[model samples]
Target: MAVTCCSVCAIQQLVSPYSAELSNGMQMAFLFALFTSAFCREAAKECRRRKKEYIKCLESRVAVLEVQNKKLIEELETLKDICSSKTD
Candidate 1:
């Protein structure tokens, strides 16, 4: 009976530490997941900010191109008048 008691105590001791280690591992995994989620959220916010800036830049470029096209059209009209006068 004494030997059985000693074996049971030894088994309990071993199992207790294994359970504690498993709990600690789960805690560490939870923390890692929390931090990774935060990092991804911040990355997504930055990408959105950059995309907004890119859209604004593209809008400005389009406006400038429209002005340039108008100027080209005006210059073409003037050239056409000059050519017609020369022909006359």
Candidate 2:
């Protein structure tokens, strides 16, 4: 199949108007994708920061509970020894 100059020119004439409109639509789509990617990056950064803070908070809570547990066990042992001595 061979397309000559006349057919090429006729095709361009028919398509030129729609080609400009298509170019503008593609430009708009590119800008929208850029903005969406930036927004998602910032959101991911914030999520990472919040997760770090939450882990630190839980670590501190675990330390506090461990101390409380040791204190209660010591007090229970003291009471048991006192009761046994008084009975003897």
Best by TM-score: 1
lDDT of 1 at 25: 72
lDDT of 2 at 9: 67
Per-residue accuracy of model 1 over 1-88 as CA lDDT, tens digit each: 1235755465556456556556767755654565566668878999999999999999999999999999999999999999999999
For residue 57, what is the lDDT in candidate 1? 100
Stretches of candidate 2 off by over 4 Å are: 1-22
Error of 2 at 79 (Å): 1.2
What's the true lDDT of residue 4 in model 1?
A: 54
Each model's TM-score? Answer: 0.73, 0.70
Error of 1 at 63 (Å): 0.3
Point to the candidate with the largest lDDT. Answer: 2
